[model samples]
Structures are given as C-alpha cells and as structure tokens.
Target: MAAKGQEFFEEQRDQSLVKAHIVSKYFDAWSNVMLGVRKQYGRIDKLAYIDLFCGPGRYTDGSKSTPIMVLEHAIKNPELASLLVTMFNDKDEANISSLREAVGALGGVGSLKHAPQIHCSEVDRDAEEMFAKTNLCPTFSFVDPFGYKGLSSRFIHAMVKDWGCDCVFFFNYGRINAGITNSYVERHMDALFGRERAEKMRGFVRTMNPRQREIYILEELAGALKDLGARFVLPFRFKRGDGHRTSHALIFVTKDFRGYAIMKDIMARESSTEDEGVPSFAYSPAEADTPLLFSLSQPLSALKGDLLKSYAGRTLTMLQIYEDHNVDKPYIAKNYKAALNELEEQGQIVANKPAAKRPMKNGQRTFSDATLVKFPALEK
Candidate 1:
C-alpha cells in the first residue's frame, strides 16, 4: 500500500553522474568500514544493517540500491558473510514487495556461502519509533528520507549514544529551505533543532543571502549532531542540474575517528575526477558537459603556508600538529608532514631531533610522539 500520491518502484528515474558518484562512495565506504570493523573487533558474533527508507532493491536500469549493495558486499566476502542481519523498512508495502522480488531474482541470501538473516517490514510509524524498537548491535543505519520531517534531534542522540552504531542520513536542503519560512513548518524545525535554536535560526535566515543561509543551516545541523554525541559529522552536498542551489546533503555521523577518516578519504576520492592532485566534483548536470575545474589548489601546498604562520614562533610535535588541525578535515599526518617539509625547504621550519646534525625532510624523517619541530623566526 503506497501513499495516495506516492508511486512505488518507478521504472524511469534519471540517474545522473552525481547520483552515481554518491552511490558509489556509499558502497565503497560501507564495504571498507565493514572490513575495518571486522578486523578491529576480531570476529564479532553479530553485525547489523538498517535501512529506514529502503526502496526497491534495484533501479530500473538494473543498478543496485543501497540495501542490495550491502547484501552483495556482505555475501561475497567470506569474513562478512556469517551472522549478518539486514533489516529494511519502507513506508510503502509495494516497495517492500518489489525489493523482495528483486532480492529473490538475485537468488537471495540462500545462494551465498553463509545465509544472512533478512527482515523487511512496512513501517507506518515515525523514524524515531522504528529506531527505538531496533535491537542493539554493531549497526550501520542508513536514514535517507525523501523529506526532513521525521528526523528529530532526540532521535539522533539515541542513535549514536551506543558504541558501534553509525548513521548516514539525507538532509534535504532544498526542502528545508523552502518550508522553513512558513509558520507551520517552524514547529517541525523545532523538533529537528531545539525550540530556542530553531527560533534563532529562523530569525537569522531572514537576513542572510542564499549561500550564507545554506552554510549557516548546515553549520547548525553539524553543531546539533555534535551536541548529540556524534564524534564526527561529515556532509557531502548535492545540487540540482542548474549548478547553483543544493538539492540535498548526505550527512555521515560516526563515533569513531577511524571511520571519519575513511569516509573523508572516500568522498575526496569519489568526488575528484582523473587527477589525484586535483580534487573536484560537479554536482550539477549543467556542468556535466564541462571538464571538472580545479577550483582549489592542492591541499598540501595550501596547508604549508597556514602551518608556517601558526607555528612561526613555537616548537611542536607531529602529534600536537595532528591534534590541533587534522581532526575534521580530509588531511592526515602524512599530508601534514608534506606541508612541514615544504615549509622546511623554504627555511620556514626546522625538523630537529636530539643530536641530529642536519634538518631532515619529512620523507627522510620518521616522526614519533617525542619528535620535536622548531619553526624559525619570520624574516624581518
């Protein structure tokens, strides 16, 4: 039973490069995290996956949807095949039926080396209620709702309060921006943000330009997630074909720094085109015909100047640098070391170890927690 106006399992929906890129990254991240977690935990008894808005298992073009992707990844890998459980929910019963058919067409989990437990249910209740009833396991939940109505702050707090649970949700920016001005939607917004913060954001959006408004709203969303105990909240934006206004943002929330690092790397790699040096993605169909413009310079090159300026008069260790600036960004210690070397070559810094005769470049040096670095005085 689909909703009155809702159509289930549409045969024809445009799949753009941007959508492909996003989906590809999602699959890659899922597989990588699954393997990494398995390795880190060393043979856990149960691993779970929950998809709140799981559509039909395949697109019209026979491309796999997220649930299908997860199933395929898990079934194909020997280590991930055992004791795996996947729970899929859809508001539309027809969509759930279609997914079942699709999964059956793939020979189902029975064809795999280890059959996984699969559960499909048509959920008429809110997202929070569905999540509350879910059994606690090491879970990766995908909450990609078409709109922003059902996701509340309290729901998010509950989701990430556990140790091994993580979530990737769709933040429909266009929908939010459109409905936010209305008085009726303000209450819903209050559920998303707190009442006081929602009122403040409403007043603030009134004076901002479109770009500023988007940035502010996203920042607020990120802040809300952080307050809810998510250690890392990374957003990947998607835009309409026109290349101006953003359609939605995919927000990944996790409690582990390692998962955060993996997602950042996946996004940076997926978004970028051919050149590893140039990282850029065109979110719009209008720019699909055009080559990917290298809008920003290489991150390492840019970070060198910032590093030199920050450490002009101070001595710091690699751990200190990593802690200070490398937490949220796509950069790691290796990138930081590259930046340090660039500064050292330009006479802006010195890599010093006890009784070392000469300053060493990052490649020639091995940095430990006790390694010391000195930034020379700026030229007068």
Candidate 2:
C-alpha cells in the first residue's frame, strides 16, 4: 500500500496530485512552527518531528517525501538542529532502507545535530512508546496510511489527549468507505471510530448498500476526530470523475485552539495561487480557478459528500467558507457538490437556494446560484 502511494507520487511528481499538496501542507506547518520558535520560544524546546507512515525520498519524478524535506528544512535553522529531533518510520523494510539511504546520502548522524531517528515499525506501536518516553516538545506527526485506512481513535487519543501533540492524518475515505459502509467494519469499528462513532455510523448507513459506504466512512471519520476533541478539520481529496472519485481527510486534531489557528495559517500558505476559476480552499468552487485535487485508490465520493454537508451546516458565504477553511476552493466545491447532491437526492432539501443580498453593481442574483446551502437543514 505504501509502495502504491510512492508509485503514485513518482508518477504525479510534477502534476496536480496528492503528493504536491501533501508536501506543501507539511512544509507550511513546519515553517510556521519555526517562526513561532524564533519569535516566541527564542529557542525550540526540543522540537520534534514524527512521521508515522513516513516513506522514503524520491517518489516518481524525484519529488521529495514530505517528512524528509521537512527534516532537511527544520534542521537548517541553527537553533532547530540543537533542539529538535526527527523520527521517520514506515512498516515497509524497503522504504525504511530508502529513507536511511536518503538521510545518509545527505550526510547522516553528523549531518543532523538533533539525532533524527528513522525506524521501521508500525506507527501505532512506536508512536505510543515514543510519546510516553519523550518530554513536552512541539510535535508534528503525519499519519499517512494506505488507501484503505490508517491509524485509530486510540492513536489520536494517545497523541492528542496531551495539549502539545499535533497530528495531520490522511483519511483515505473512498477506500475505507467501500468497506466501512458495508460489513467490513463490523469487527474493528471500535478501533477505527472510537466505540461511539462506530456504533452511530453502523446505524446511519445500515440500510445503505456498498455505494453509500463513502458517505458513512467520511462522517464516521469526522465524528472520530471530533470525539478526540479536534477544534476543526478540513479534508483533502483527489477526484477521478463527476461522481466517482478518491478522497482523503487531511484531518487536523488538537486540544488547543492555537493548533486550529496554525492549521488555517498553513493551508492558506500552501494552496494553489493559480486561478482555476474556483475558490482556493482544497474544496473550492469551480470558478475559484484553483486546482489541487489528486488521486489514490479510494472511492470517497460519499465521504466527501458527508463532509461537504458538514461544511454547509456552519458556513454561509464564499468569504465565510474561506475564513472557516484553509483547503483550496476547488476541493471545497467538490466536497460541497457531493454533499449537496446527496442531500437533494435524498429529498432532504425541497427549496434550497442561495441567500442573496442586493447587488448594487449587477442584479444577476437570478442566476447567481453557485453558493452552497442545505434546505430543511439535513443532519444537524
């Protein structure tokens, strides 16, 4: 599975794919912390970087793995090397070897003063132990699991229950939903959604067939992150068709609001500057002129749909959408359309329309209906 993403990474290194967004997002967050360290901390308090499913460098077109690039950049700060540590882990032995070689090629051991540890092990096992052993230090972990799914509620709980830990997990909604909305999750749901979510999700999509799995998985995931007490989360997706696609949740969960602020800051910094005639958030509208969607092996339309409705529940206008989320607008629009269509298809909305104010310049509000809203307010 890890190899597959690597392959995809190599294939889409220069194109608009998941790898680009993934790397950019990480660097944004890492650099933000670096700024904080310089301005406030004045000295990083043992700054630490952890990649749960960190793969090796050079995916397809020599594009760098996020963790490795982040490590390289972080240590470049004079204070970072002396105070920070990098722990990059993967379950694949080959990937681990590649990571080691990558670090070595760049000059290992002596190259980095923080003594970054690159290990080969399941992140769940290693993350827990590492957390228990380390003292309070700013941490950033990338839980990029395979397309099916990755990590668990316990994983989020253990790392985040403490206020200092901040994690960004890749929720492969399409792949997981194909199974989750079905009977595949019957056994280990508790592991995935934290009991409460598992049970609620099971009930929500019980009558749904395999096709509805994506929605169920996405809802369950957002619910799980909420369970872990996340302030806010925005998804990242890669679409293949109008309704069929692959999507993942780049969920940010943290106990502190600063973390939420930090995520928002990072997303805005990393999204496309190009005008794709759509909003720039990961889920921006088509007119936003932004495109960052990528592909994986997951079928996540339903999950993406659920998340879009989640957005409609709170957001009102393009400005509000931009303020509340940091993902590109095209991505937001994708999620928005999925959820809106789902809501409408289910007869949840009878007269849903955009709430328009008087346009002094142009009274084209008659056809100005690209804004999102849910009639009858489905799924409060």
Candidate 3:
C-alpha cells in the first residue's frame, strides 16, 4: 500500500520527514560537483555517494524525487558513470526497498559503461564494519537525517578515520530545540559530547527554542565534532519565506586545505541563493562582532567565549587566534582577562600568569592568552 497524494505532498514539503532541500537548490550544488568528479576522472573509479538516511524514492506527486534523480542526471554523462558509485541507507525497511527498486529501473544507458553500485540497507547497525567491507574511498556523502538519533558521532568518527570522504550532514536545529533541552537527551549526553567532557557533570540541556538553546549546546556540538576531527564547517540556515522553516548544516571534514576551499565554495553558493531568500556567505568570520545594545538579546559575543575555549591548548598569536577562532583581539584580551579574574575569585580556571604588561610595537601593552600555567585550588 502507498500513501495518498495529499499525504505524500505534505511529507515532501517538510524536510523533517523527507529531505526537501535535496530536491531543491542544495541538491543542485551537491550533485553537480559530485557528477563533475566522475566526468573529470573519466572512469577512473575514485568517487562514491552515501545517502545516510535516504527516504522512499519518490513522493506521491513525483516532484520531490532525490537520489534517483541525482543518479539519472549523472548517468547521462557517460564519462561520469565509469567513476561514480552511490549507496543509500534508511532505518525504514520500506524506504530501503523503494530505493533498490528505483535503482533497478534506471538500468543501462548508451556508452554508460559503468553502472553505479548502490547498497540499500535498513539503518547501518555497524557502520565501521560496513566501511571496512566496502573499501571505497568516497569523494562525497549525503548524511541528511531527520534527527540526532538517526546518525551517531561514533559512526561519523569511523567515516573520518576509514573512508576519508567529504561529508554533508543535516544539523536539524528543530531537533536540537525540541529534543536537546529535554532531560531525555541528557541521559545520552555522552554520545553528544564525549566521555571526558561528560565527566565534568551538569544538568546542561535546559529547554529552549532552537535559537535560544543553541547558544551553548551547538557550540559544544561544534567542539565535539572538532574533537572527532572535522574542519571547514559552516552552519547554514535556509530561510524559506513561507514562515514554516527548518534548520540544517552542511559540513566537509577533511585534512586537506584543498577540500576546505572547495567546501567554502559549495557553502557560499548553497547559502547565498535567491531561492532560499538569503544572501550567499563567503566566509567564516575571524571575529565575533558584539555591538552593545545592537544585538542586545542574542549577542554573537556570548558565542565568542566558546570560540575561545575551543582554541585552548594551542599557542596562537593575536592575529592567528582572530583568524582561526573568530574573535577580535580586544574582546579576547578583555574577556580572557575577565574569565581568569572571575576564576581566580571563585577558583575555576587558575591563571598561571598574573596580570603582566608586555612591550608592543605601538607601546607597552597587555596580553591575555600568553600561555599561563594552571593553579590548583588549595583546601583551607
């Protein structure tokens, strides 16, 4: 039995169920590059696409087909087929069945010497073992899932370690808003953050709207992903003027600076289109700009602190920290000093170096992140 027409359209409209963006412009930006890799390689066999939470192949209306359409378009260019392979997985057995049927329908084409190898599965119970079995070095993967539970940081770690591919994941801010703040999520906080971090103790996820809660939770999530080894991540919001909206992110995790540059281009184009009703972004800001009374409610500076914390354990020049972590030299100095001063008062992060003055090119000056030692708290 299939879903009714209206039922299908409703699901297609909201990405919380079926991926709406994939049938939209993000689909174009992602697939064009993927297919181009195949064409450029000329049957060289160096690329693959893994849709981690692929839904059933087509909506009832037939307008919102994704992975199948992507494959159809790529196969048109015979050169691409020789080099590309696609894999799709879903926890739902029905969707997995639909995907295989869809792939089978798109059989041989003229001069399309190679057919894509698509493995449709009901959720990956053990992704690491599957990674080892496939032995495919991927060029790209589409990891758009409905919520946090669909994918795990553990599976993500394996992909980074074993496959070494560029990954695009759906952040689903809605889930973070509705689910993360709930105590139910707290029980599994170790999966979200890590063990050492979880050991630090707290009732962290207080209920909040997506925007309100993200102030702390998302910053930590970014830190966790970094701890899992990811870079060149840009958080993107696709604003559909309909007032009904969804929040998601596209990330590329790779060690090479080249991959970082390509991801920048992809995010810039994806985020900056007229269709999404937003301007394209061209950068990861090097400074958290806080204008007092300007953004009084949700200041970017609040996030600025976590940005600083993420940079801990690394020696950075003022310029380097600004460039790498997105905070101005003045704010870093003031806040860094304020944090240590407060900690010294309450005993949290002990400052190894007392307030000291150093000579600068302009004049005598003070520095905050001058590599201070930790002071252990003494019992009275």
Cα error, candidate 3, residue 222 (Å) = 1.8
lDDT of 3 by residue, 1-380 (tens): 54677544443364332234433344444445555665676443555666777777776555435677667766765555665566677777777677677777775633345454445554444664675355556546667666666465555555655433666576666565565436677544566567555444234544444455554555666667778776544454433323234344444455444455445444444332221122233111111122121223332334334544565444444334434443211122333433434444454443444434333333323444554535333334
The better candidate by TM-score, 1 or 3, is 1
Per-residue lDDT of candidate 1, residues 168-221 (tens digit): 777888888876677878877887777877888888899999999988998888
| Highest lDDT against the true fold, candidate | 1
Give each model's whole-structure lDDT: 0.66, 0.56, 0.50
Q: For every model shown, what is its TM-score relative to the native structure?
A: 0.79, 0.63, 0.57
Which residue pairs clash in candidate 3?
272-280, 286-326
Per-residue lDDT of 221-281 in model 2, one digit per residue for the tens?
Answer: 7667776676555554443223244454566667665556556545544443323222233
The CA lDDT at 322 in model 1 is 68
Stretches > 4 Å off in candidate 2: 1-17, 20-24, 27-31, 34-44, 107-111, 124-136, 147-150, 181-185, 206-216, 241-243, 265-380
Model 2 RMSD to the real structure? Answer: 9.8
Task: Please report the TM-score between candidate 1 and the true structure.
Answer: 0.79
Q: What is the lDDT of residue 72 in candidate 1?
A: 75
